[model samples]
Target: MILAPYYFNEKTNLSEQPYRNQKRRLEGRSIRDLPLYSQELLDRIRLPAERDLNDDPCWLRTYYDPSSEDSWGQIQDYIDTKIGGPVTVYNDSSLYNFGSNWEKIFLRAPQLLDNTCLFEEYEEYVEEALEEGIESESGDAQHAGENGYDPVEDENPWICFYSEYLFRLAAGHIYIVDEKTLASEGPDAGTVLVMWYDECGRAIRYYREEAMHAAEIANLAPCYLKDYACWDNAEIGESYEWGAPLGPPYGENRREASE
Candidate 1:
């Protein structure tokens, strides 16, 4: 269940737009990837803060270092001390003293427990990173690259995560589905269905479903995933006919098969 004992879960190079023809026109050129996004934009996405600090609002932070799980807990502590403990506030004045007043109420939102921050935990961890306009502490949540993520960490095994590096984690598993197999079987709980075509003109399933849970991937086996939603994707049903009603005789139901 313990995988990469010493990897961090923080990757920040995913929020960039690829150039139109940089690779072909400019062989030896590079440019800044992440353009500035306004803090106001982030505020629109943050959760509203508590009653006293309603002006600032709260934002959840994620860890992306991909090397340390302890950092998440430590950051939580750091945030608490910076804003206010769950029930206490050290600085009455406001982050405005630091010119980021909007973040004062958000420094450590008092109501994080109201909803889950990310898909993994059912609790929210508040912070002020959103006002800074930089990706939050947990990790970048926007884009994914093919070969840059790993989900297991022996050192930080408590914090289970997914990787989009060389392999992707579907819901949490190494999603591997071929066309023939996709046609044969439908989707699973966390798995997603993808559509790719072969010479025969049949819509094939190329990817497997994501892992059932983060805990499902606590092992050493490698798994890669492409982000997708089942019952979705253009090619699955539109371009290709992957939606034929399967014949009867379904596999033994894992359920009680209600009356």
Candidate 2:
């Protein structure tokens, strides 16, 4: 599964703060009393013709089936055209940490253990570790301790490691968009052109195809990939915004400077 950030339409009432503020109950102040809450603001906010308000931007999750011959072909073509040739696995010795149980599992039964099983096993291990408070000599455990594990937090390195492991198993290597490349190339580069293969080359390139916009706003490029069980159920060719060049306010300054 590929997850991409939602691109919001700026020329919409939903995108305005006043419209969003209407949903909230202002404790002491009237909604109209707020700054920028005026008829002028409402008049200025224009909805796109024939566009549904419900069609607001949202993070998109697209699933592809590697099992299907047709789907697999498309996936391969995309990797080849967009991501370039896969890096030699031997070049990056750190790709598969021999110490990881996930790596061990992959070596043992790469076909048998799906994503769900890996997640369950990871959760189980975390639970066992937390319950027992066993400070092991293993690198992962030591790293987890140093990072400070919190059950509620998604930022846990342990969880991130497993997530990447699952992605790597499917793709064989991951490519991350380089920061310098983004700054230099801007949004026109897209995620494809700016990405570099991760030093740990176990799998395919995983990136946010529309991350240039993200970089413009947040100054960060986020990337993630997941393997799903219900790949057959998802609609093919429904993953919109893949490989599309980023829109305005992203590379505008850089382009202007160059021009």
Count of residue pairs whose backbone atoms collide, per candidate: 40, 6
lDDT of 1 by residue, 1-259 (tens): 1111001111112211122122236555322232436444444444333322221222222212333234334433443444332322222222212221222322444232121112322111111211111222135433222222244422221111111111111111111212222132344422322322211122322333342322132122321213333211222222122222210011111011221
Question: What shift in Å separates residue 139 of candidate 2 from its native position after superposition?
Answer: 12
TM-score of each: 0.16, 0.17
lDDT of 1: 0.24
Global lDDT of each candidate = 0.24, 0.27
Model 1 spans with C-alpha error above 4 angstroms: 1-22, 32-187, 194-237, 240-259
Q: What tens digits encode model 2's per-residue C-alpha lDDT throughout 134-249? A: 22312345555453455566333333223332232231221222232233344533342212121122222224444433222222212221332111111112111122221212
Model 2 misses residue 23 by how many Å? 55
